[model samples]
Target: MNPPAEPPSRAALQAAASQRLHPLSWLFLLLAQLRAFALPLLVLLFGGGRREDGIADLIGLLAAGLLALTAVWRYFTYHYGFLGQALVIRSGLLQRNLRLVPFDRVQNVTVHQNLLHRLFGVASVRLESAGGLGQAEAQMDVLRLDQARALEALVRQGAQRARAAAAASGEGPEAATPAEPAPVLWLHLPMRELVRLGLISNRGMLVVAALFAALSQAGDAVMKPLGNQLYAGLKEGESWAASLHLGPLAYGLASLLLLLGLLALVRALSVALAIVQFHDFRLLAGERELSVERGLLSRVRAHLPKRRVQAYTLHESLLHRWFGRRSLSVDRAALETGNEAAALRELVPLATPEAMDGMLQRLLPEGSWPPRHWQPLHPRAWRRVAFPGLLATLAASGLLVAWKGLPGLWLLLLLPLVVLRARIWARYSAWSLEGGVISVRQGWLDRHWRFAEVRKLHALELRQSPFDRRHGMASLHLDSLGAHPMAPPLRIPYLPVAEAVRLAAALRAGMPRDAGVSRARTAA
Candidate 1:
């Protein structure tokens, strides 16, 4: 190489005119249009699900044309540039939008490449900001991979500089520019593990979705005609419906079997989804950063600072438990509230419990784990846990009796199953406090291991509803830096009142006063 060009000066960037995305963006926009109108496209190709051919075609063409027009307009009008420490993006068709996102508030920067972009050698860059407050602070739909990486690097630098400025404002040299980030590959899912992950992940959810789509699409055309034929056959033969009788217990058993069958179907679908999404999953740990790369159909590279993680969960679904493995998700402090995808970053696709321990140790050496005794909640915790389940069982039985007459009394059989589940939960759920960290083992059919450093604790609360109060039971609730919808709190429910108060008090006093990031945010 002759010489590396000097990085452009900040002043130069300030003087640069706003720029539109690469012309190739039109292709990306067209793909977006197709994705947005996928249902309509299905109706066009397969027919029957929607209205008449004429009406469906008219709506489909109008929607596609409108989507295409909007994409073109957005591509042409959108412009982005840097101004001092802020990134600015302006765009609009009839109205106008000029957004200036300060680097200090930037929470994440990600580079994404789907199959189409791969063919075209382009990527999309998203600069996410504080708490996902509004649509990403700024995003570039199409850029050459090299240019996208450069922009991501620049965004990271701007955020670093802003942090330095903030730190120096109060504590001179205390938060001086941190050392250069040193990245190390800590964990990469192997092909064998990927297969195991596929076997255990949530394919059931996809199966349910597929079932709904089939009903919505082909119900009238296929199911109705099929149902008519079945009815005709039944009328011509013995009328089995009139001869059969079912007690509530028989009904309950039938329902249970049906549910189990449905669950199996869902599990099968989840396995397929896991393979496609986690074909080459990898996690890299650094001094102050974390990197994740995964996806088979669409390559995704996610960059995260260690300080940004608020909390993480180690989940063991029933299927996963059978395979002796667990999955992990990390919640970012600045993640947007409703972004299901970005908010839950997969820390590990799948690993045996022992391997999970090793991986966590490699990524978090200071973090504690077993060989220590686990402390279960109070023995009487079973009472509180079982109370709700009993009430529900009774209510359901009563409803069945009212609707189906005396035979419905057999519904009482469900109560035992509910109570058994509660008993299992009380037996397995436990919490332990060690070395400034709190670990909770939760879930009954599925298991979860959640960790939070006590020093990084943000807030603590003790709760005792009337039901809990009647039984001298209380729950200790703790809040850490990160928040997530899927991530449950590091809570110990149905503990003795004294234990709850004592735990809450200890956490409040032990919380870190000097360090900025807490246990969940630690890099290692």
Candidate 2:
């Protein structure tokens, strides 16, 4: 008898249907690359009569030619397909890469459209997977807007099938049937609220914007000479005050006036940025997802799975607190892969304390969602705060004396400010655990009322520093899935040592019994 035919190899058995990106993908890729060079091009345009144009033009043309060639090459070489339980992409012109993204592991599918894409009627699609760290596992760089949406629907169907198959065999994460989220408006921030958000936000961002504007506005003749002078003075070790030939007092006064002018400019720019970025801010909560859409000239539409929201941070700056307003953000797990678009979203531009609490209740429904009463930390917390302020005051005094000589004695008047700060910290910094939530209210100058559902807590710890131990105090720290480097740490510092340990234990008790309990093995 003929030997049984050898079983088909995996690749042969699971055939992939190959496809190319949208034909307009070349233009999309080319523009995506060219956008980064826009700043450099603008800088060259303002060469201010200090530089010749011929060399710059030649270099720009060559760079543009190379970028276009690469885009063309990439479009021709790349291919993607649905292949046996995975979406596989074979890409790269010189060195090929094969990426197989399993349907069961897909975390999210994102669609993006910019002005150029919208103008051309094409969009971008990104497939996010677990552990990808904020970057898409595979992206369909350009497609018709409807096509992108269709691709997203296809992925969701695949994921649902995978989950259903797993459940049939008694293993797999369960999810409800996927459906289009009918838009439900939770909040629509008005222009007035956006303006208030501007006042509370940082004004320093204006300096960066102004610097870019100056590069484009000033000619090479103006910018180059100014740059050379600043560079030469720095290389020569001459202070700016000394270089101007002004006396110490005149230099000091002039510097102060310049700073005041900068502050005014920053305030104006902040207002403009707020108006531009949040002109028609709208938040929508759906059955399975939450979406935020904002921006005036260019738009951004971002969504987060409701179950993937790991934490919430409400920031109330001193100015905001004074005005009885707070801003809210949610940490989305989609950012774990380092996706810039999936970072923490400001859900509320500006709201009163009561309004914020109501929003939180709607977002995280627990027995006692946002516990009102906060337990005060150890009294020593204020002393811990006081020492740092005093140190800062002393440092400021020394710097002033070195800069302007005898006039620096004015720094002594700041001692009262330090005392006031300590009192503020003593009054506001506290935490509590009520019902099934962990609540913390913190900050002296800029305050926030933070809370998380206990069932969501992933990890907890208690620690004591040398100072903390000496003062009979410890700190309690909580870790959730979506930790952001820029967001504030969830820590309650300067709590009684015993209290801190108790809090840790309580959080451990609150965790899911089926998930976190460690099993002890008996000796074999």
What are the clashing pairs of model 1? 202-270, 203-266, 203-269, 203-270, 204-266, 204-267, 310-482, 456-518
Over 1-524, each residue of candidate 2 has an lDDT whose tens digit, in order, gives 33434543446423452678889899889988989787776556444344454776776678789999999998888777786567877788579676777787876776767678778888788777657776678888898888888877788678767776676555655644444457688778798887777777865486677888988787776789988998997777557556778878886898799898988777777877887777788877776667777777555555567777777888888889777888887766656442225323566777888977777777776557667677998987888888877888889989999999978879978888887878788778888788777878887767776667778877676667677777988887776776667778887878897887777777888886643432111112
Looking at model 2, residue 521 earns an lDDT score of: 16
lDDT string for model 1 (1-524, tens) is: 23434655644553453777888897688887788779768767567655554777786778778888888888887878877787877778579766777787777777888888888899998877656754676778999898899888888888778778767676334385765576778778777787787677765576678877887767667888878998999696545533567667876897799799877776667666777777687787766677788877788877777767766688988888788888888766665532224423677768778877876665443647652668788787877778878888788888988999888889788888877888899999888887667778889888887877776667666777777777777777777765676687778787887887777777777876643322221111
What TM-score goes with each of the models? 0.75, 0.76
* Local accuracy by lDDT, each model: 0.74, 0.74
Give the range of the ten consecutive residues with the poorest summed lDDT in model 2.
Answer: 515-524
